[model samples]
Target: MTYLPLPQPRTTPVRVMTIAGSDSGGGAGIQADMRTFALLGVHGLVAVTAVTVQNSMGVKGFHEIPLDVIAGQIDAVASDIGVQAAKTGMLASSAIIDTVAGAWRQQGLAGAVPLVVDPVCASMHGDPLLHPSALNSLKEQLFPLATVVTPNLDEVRLIVDVEVVDDASQRDAARALHALGPQWVLVKGGHLRTSSRAPDLLFDGTEFREFDAPRIDTGHDHGAGDTLAAAVASALAHGYTVPDAVAFGKRWVTECLRAAYPLGQGHGPVSALFRLNE
Candidate 1:
């Protein structure tokens, strides 16, 4: 007897998109994000803004993608397949940031999508990834659209001119940055005030949620920020609440860093697929 037709898939996979650069080091940027999404059971898409020549040690060189090309990439993914959640990282220039912000505005993705903005200025190995001129555009254009802005202590100073090295400073910095318009702001305190513990402050306009973890003393964290931001976006795309998503994201990054493998001569990358083996 002939078999009946098979049923179609019940639902589309949660789609998370990363608009960032390509790191040849395979640690940070879009590559890390994709891996995070995959490990989290979400679909990952990318619109790379630049090509970075980097290793664990430091960045050697970077080539910016043309503004038109960036725009085209955004349009192609956003129009056809579409994205449920997305994040921005390593937009090399003001023009590139302007282009992406304009595209998002034009696409009217403001409230329709959950957006994470990881203002990636400097690399982990003390290399600058974003141009100084682009900082203004990021604050004026992109910050307002972000559902969550994940900035390390240094990046917080770069954006809002506020110090976030201590608990008190982190609170004030979160408030000041929330004023700039992100619905939620997370000031990561893993680097600064690095004494014994790692504390992160998440300010949701009205309240503050602090997450602390015992700092894993290791240099094998190449894509910690990218991985965290991407994991948050992935969780949000899968319909998790902001607080829960951030918590899970933080835990995920910690585990990745803990299980990081020694690769190149410098700091290696956090394993985005840690959950897969768990």
Candidate 2:
């Protein structure tokens, strides 16, 4: 006898928005953030700030989106579609950074919703991704609004002027960044050459916590930072606390890094495709 099939209820995922640049390479920026969000069981939204012309090799150039449009995108999503958590990346100018920060305040997501700020100023290959004039604006206008700011060693140097030569210095850098007013700051140690096993340091106003992803020895780690930040935002949307979310993010990006593969003439992107099965 043939049994009749019953329909199951359609489910909606928690939404996590990425306010960043559009990577034509499909490796980093908005592409990486969205890919990471979806792989982690969350709905992905975007408010693209720039259109970058680049590939695995490096960023060639980028064009910023209009200020009004950038803010409108955030407002549109926050008003009707809704966002559970959000992130910022590759805001190439002071004006754009200010626009994004103001949009978050207007939408009431500045402190109310978890925001992961990835202070992306350059590519791994040393290609500039941010304008020289915008650095001060990023630190002043955006950092305070973040729930967690994830900065790699280079960004650590750029942000706090502390060269993280060792674990102790990593703590110092996190302490410095925490003073910038983010609720928490994660100092990523992936670029540390002094140690074989690089660990990340998280500092709140009170104490410190550490997270270490199993090091995957691969150069095709183009989107690792974006992936980590996006994963943190996704976990936040799932109602995880800041520390737990960062822990989950570190674990997730480690897997992505492990599965990274070359795509072009240069470094490829860290892949969340592996998580599709998990």
For lDDT, the strongest prediction is 2
Candidate topping TM-score: 2
Q: Write the per-residue lDDT of candidate 1 for residues 14-56, one digit (tens) a residue.
A: 7888999999989999999988877776778888899999887
Candidate 2 has what TM-score? 0.95
Worst 10 residues of 1 by lDDT: 1-10
> Deviation in angstroms for 136 in model 1?
0.8
Badly placed stretches (over 4 Å) of model 1 are 1-11
TM-scores, one per candidate: 0.94, 0.95
- Clashes per candidate, residues 3 or more apart or on different chains: 0, 0
Candidate 1 residue pairs that clash: none
Alpha-carbon lDDT, every model: 0.87, 0.88
